[model samples]
Target: MTVTSAASEPGDRRGAFLLLGAIILVWGINWPVMKVGLGSIPPFWFGGLRLLLGSISLFLVAAFRGRLTLPALADWPVVATVGLVQMAGFLALVNIALLHVPAGRSAVLCYTTPLWVAPGAALFLGETLSRRKLAGLALGLAGLLILFEPGSFDWSNRPLLLGNAFLLGAALLWALTILHIRGHRWHGSALDLAPWQQLTGALPLLAVAFLVEGGPDAIDWKWSTLLVLAYNGPIASGFAYWAAVAVTRRLPALTSSLAFLAVPVMGLTASAVALGEHPQPALLLGFLLILIGLVLVEYKPRKPAA
Candidate 1:
């Protein structure tokens, strides 16, 4: 299955970095947003509604831009697979984990996506593990370890263990999607299929919600709930997903994976501010390590000979 992005050629680093920053900012805040939504919405229905609204938002934007179209016959399977794993599987897992885990802790575990992506990129995409990238990977993992605070986590507690495992599954599934997207040969730009993939992913969830969770009526409608859902659907999941796909095509897979380390840091920070969760000093140190890791991962050396 071939995944395609908006640009066939490599993208401008400056623009990609700018998109990265925006993705982190919006998605980082989404932790609190999801937490807020879960307050008035059942987890499965909330996840399904988010994808439904997100699909609508993307389709509208693509139509307005005259870029909306169905995926090619050859692309449908890839689209369905990604929709299932990346959207339905990952989100459902994370939502369930969030019910038992703190937003910050869950974010940390999910951001371990890089650990999974790096090896897959090397094996499947044939991306090299450059010295700087290796250093960055090490630094990022170290930072995550510090932030994870394993000694403090109650591994003995069944709920915490289950929540953490759910998050880990989310991370692995997300990594598989990233690897697939990175290797996909283009039949259409990622943006062109965004709505379709989102909708495809939502269908299963919607069915499950109707059968298991009793459908959208299960949602407790409130101003705050509607506001966050709107933000998530249009801005965070819709725009951010497009931007990420475009940027991922431009950057090395390893670099993209390492950069993901920033999201959890931002999520942690936003959760602290919005949810009144106190931050530990390790959080600050983790931020520094991630920045350094990003720098290392992104740095490119000039070729010595042709």
Candidate 2:
């Protein structure tokens, strides 16, 4: 995936930074929230329900912000790409993969989308990959390796292997979405397009959920379950997705992607606290490398020629 901004440098770096932080927090915590949810709900149903809630909440928020509108015809391709590939395809695979893989591992694997995006951006979008950015990418990937703790990932187990494969597939879809987003000529704010994208993704998600999981009778909707589902909805999916799109649009793709590496670290820490899955000592080093990488990636971004 490419790290270049296909558009001009964002005028509002502060706002984009804040939104990026929000996205990281919501999605990082969602790792464990989802782990808990899947214990009681089937994967397909759980994914669909959460996305449906996301779409409704997003529409309300967009309307409240006076940004709600039908997507422009030019934006429809982006909408479909993000909605179907990023939201539905990625979430569905992640949810199913989470059934077999640990949440921390899943986060680490799925966030590897940047590895594919960096080269892609240079090739397809003509974004320059500076030496600093490339180094940051390498260090960040190293951190991911440490967090993943490859030795522990049971390559021999069929289910676990397949789950890992699913995560990589999700990452690919996400990379494609990112590339499309960077290259797209937007006619509206991320807020304006967010609800439509959610609606697009939600339709297929719900349809697939109904087909695969049958009726929702299998769901055990206890108080804990309801809370988990709610967190996954408006907070994690709707708001996080909106914020993520905003961040991607505003920041250098490399900068945003490297910063996003922080999510799995947060997820790892959160998983430890929420799920009682303690991190290995090596993961502490991984955390340091990732942050350093983020700093390096954002260091001295080139200014446009006057």
Candidate 3:
């Protein structure tokens, strides 16, 4: 498969890795930053505000590059659907979940998108579902069970349970979005439509915030809160989203997903350092299992010469 991207040089694995590393770092740190932002704002409004800002930032870049134009009419449906599912749905659900779950643990659960994507690709796109990948899936499930079992998480804690469930839902929605992107026959460059999609997704969220949460003034914007929003919007959502999409386009789905696993690991570390979240035994065990599973899924053995 050829990966055609503005940033990609032909046969450039090193460039891809560098891009992936930057994404993991930005996104990983953004987890704790998001938690901090939510401390000062409600979930829906926080998401809306970030998207709105990010969209504007991205539009500026697009316009500067002379690439800002309306999406072709035929592409609007795909853009709208992707905007809703990927930006609005995924962010809203994850933000709600973060209200209950700690940032590190939330990151871990949310990245389980790959487990769904691998199978979905096989079923719908005719990608190979090899035995290694199945084993990896089993291992990842074992990790989830270890993380979520009654022995690990107190079932009596309703918020935690609900939060975890929401994260899982977000992961599934994200997986669906991935499949959609993979299948989309782009009428224009995906990069060109990215800001528009972000803008489109932000509209409903802003509407909901006004209708349900009262209005934009509801946000009690501390300087720290404003700072986090700046980081989340321009760096995380704007640059990071585009970088991620570019990197994913340049790699295989499973490989892209596996590389994304770094986000949670960095999130975990950042949460521990920045948010002072303690790691639990079950979380450690689950993290290890999930890491192993990802490695298995991405591993490709070489054939010997005859």
Candidate 4:
């Protein structure tokens, strides 16, 4: 569990909360950062390069802690699942969607993964589907409906529609990744395996970048552009990933879920501040509905007669 002692023993509950807060901040702001990066590079290249730097940063972290090692043979499947689906596919698609979608709104759409994950968990993980969960699902879908309401969304706008589709797809992919991670018995701590997964995810992405964007020539290389790119790597992806895993290993699940929900909220706020994105009334209402649903979903009722 060297996630490196994972350093995440229960005694460090305060530390875990601190890390969770950091994760929310970094990941939330990251939405606008990715959107900004797209201005300087094509989506695929932007995603690939950012991911590559993140992987390298992770590798360095593992090495510096003397915890660096190849993934355990048994861990490779989970690594590939996480790397390809969550790290590579989900992120790549999200970046592409940012090319068309506004950052704040896209943040709302992309975070719908938990709504999908609840049902999938019940079916696949043999978890109980409680009444609260059902209610949560209903409310979450209501939110989605509001966002997609005819009066609000211009479905006639193809690029916007496509961008929303991509974000939803990314959410689904992330849910699938989490389901797989849940089903798989772990042979290594998340920290130990994470760097390898990053590399596994990054290599194919760079290949795609090569074929699609054709080289480094397209990158803007401006100061603001490079600054965000650097931020995406070490701070957002690397440290955030590490901190999240460590916090997950330490904190109560419900606490983690409730805390993590701040990500989209922060994303919306950051988008407004950084990208000048003002939320429409419908979008804001939809966002509120989704947050309430998530709170319900993470609420665990008592076990009957246990």
Candidate 5:
């Protein structure tokens, strides 16, 4: 009998990298699209509807592929927990933040997931905090502080302050979700679990959206809005999230997480190009620090075999 390995082959690694790159690119461009779309749609409404569409699409795909399996009852609670923290909490906050902050600024803040993850992993996940990771965490926080001061904190208005707080809450929840998922036993690919989580979590969001936005009748249709929904729902959530899970299975968690550093940088650049937002020098510096931190976090020391 021939034996098969679960580890990805060299060819598979290359494909994973390509898929990861595409995910980053699509998500990068999506930042500006979301900002533009939120101009017309309420933030909660937009997030709820987008997630609803993504859940339906992903569930249909999972059903068709015959790979769908229900999580054990024990697993369902964790799944729901993660869904609320990562999907609902994070998405709603970011969506709301977009209304107050520039897309690029909001993207940078949200992508600070790594900063939170390092500590969370160390404390909760029992992952050893290496010197490199600690340094990287410091560097990332420094960068974030630079970005956060004056710019992110300048909430001259009440909505802006609420938005900023919401974004921070989202980031914290997302970091917690990541830690939980990594520590727990989830029996399928992100493709498999994502649909269930989204479908279930979306129920609350749908209610909130209706309560806040006052129903579908209040939504105005625009071509840009439709484009945002399609991109964020199908391409970004469906495809990008799946690609991330696939890559994480192949690469070390730290390595895959480091790749996320590209998301904010790409988002910032895309915003400048697409939305005509000018880059500030401090923001550029912050981006540099973030990149440096990512590099440090992913740096692996070679082990000599005995």
Candidate 6:
């Protein structure tokens, strides 16, 4: 019985790890997939559709599990904030940015979330900003400078800059969201919050997509585009979001951040192999520094107990 229990523990952990890996793979590939999808639909429309589908799927799952709960009237404001930040602010900008910047380049820029989170956490949550984290932030910012050189600036490329800016803004918003969720008086598992947030947040986007993109008729349908859309909606947004919330409960925040290190690298590598985009040397160096900074930020030293 002892041996069986020990073996089962490892198996369980491995399953969790595999699930996390799958989430990263799907999300990493999603960068290029969004680029492909955007060719056939406008950014707001695509975001609206994806979130609509995701909301439906998540609601169905919640219903099936008997876990669906409507958001309280007071929580509407928080839901709206998350919706605007994650769906409208982040996805809309990223979708449009893909037209101007390579998918790989944009992915690198977006995953700079940890850099922003380190300081935000310190300021908002009273989390300590250790020397190591400060050093990491410096290194990561240096890398960003290399990636976004002065020569790369051009008004004609406004969309790309806008996208990068939106992603950075989204990261800050996400950090705030994290702070909000942790402190808010919600009465459910994180899984329960997922569908409510997606559905609630998608309302404005739905309206905008319909008004701007001529409803569903605007989409120039293609199998490739549809496949990407489905993947992002159901698998990436629906399942992956739940999985991440589940895993974070079992792992420390630092450990979770370490796990996500794989995401940006995989995103860039997959973009190169699948999309035939080549990253510049400076860009490569920038990613290296970002990775190093992430490690520094997440590394924790043991403290003496009172």
Q: Name the better of 1 and 3 by lDDT.
A: 3
> Global lDDT of each model?
0.78, 0.79, 0.83, 0.83, 0.76, 0.74
In model 3, pairs of residues that clash are none
Q: What's model 5's TM-score?
A: 0.90
Question: Candidate 3 on 239-274: residue-level lDDT in tens?
Answer: 887777678666665567667778899999999999
How high is each candidate's TM-score? Answer: 0.83, 0.82, 0.90, 0.94, 0.90, 0.89
lDDT tens digits by residue: candidate 1, 1-306: 112323334659889889989988988899988987888887778778888888999899998998888899878867887889988998899998888887876777776665666667888999997777788879977876776578886778898788878998997898898788777665866778889988988888888888987856788888998898899787887888878877778776556655656788889889999999887778667656755765676566667996
Candidate 4, residues 179-250, lDDT tens digits: the string is 888788788778788778877888888889889888888788899888988898778878888888788779
Show how many residue pairs clash in every candidate, following the order shown.
Answer: 3, 6, 0, 0, 0, 0
- Runs in model 3 lying further than 4 Å from the true structure: 1-8, 11-17, 246-257, 300-306
Model 1 clashing residue pairs (backbone)? 2-184, 2-185, 3-184
Report the lDDT of model 4 for residue 148. 69
lDDT of 6 by residue, 33-76 (tens): 88888889888788877887888898999999887788777666
| Model 2 misplacement above 4 A | 1-22, 140-153, 242-260, 282-306
Model 5, 143-173: lDDT tens digits are: 8678656655656788877876777787788
lDDT of 4 at 23: 89
Better of 4 and 5 by lDDT: 4
Q: Pick the candidate with the highest TM-score.
A: 4
Residue 37 CA error for candidate 5 (Å)?
0.9
- Give per-residue CA lDDT, model 2, range 195-224, as digits (tens): 777778778878887787877777887999
Give residue 62's lDDT in candidate 6 (0 to 100): 90
* TM-score, model 3 to reference: 0.90
* Cα displacement (Å) at residue 265, model 1: 2.9
- lDDT sort, best first: 3, 4, 2, 1, 5, 6
Pick out the ten consecutive residues of candidate 1 with the lowest summed lDDT.
Answer: 1-10
Question: Candidate 5 — which residues are off by over 4 angstroms?
Answer: 1-11, 151-156, 252-254
Error of 5 at 233 (Å): 1.3
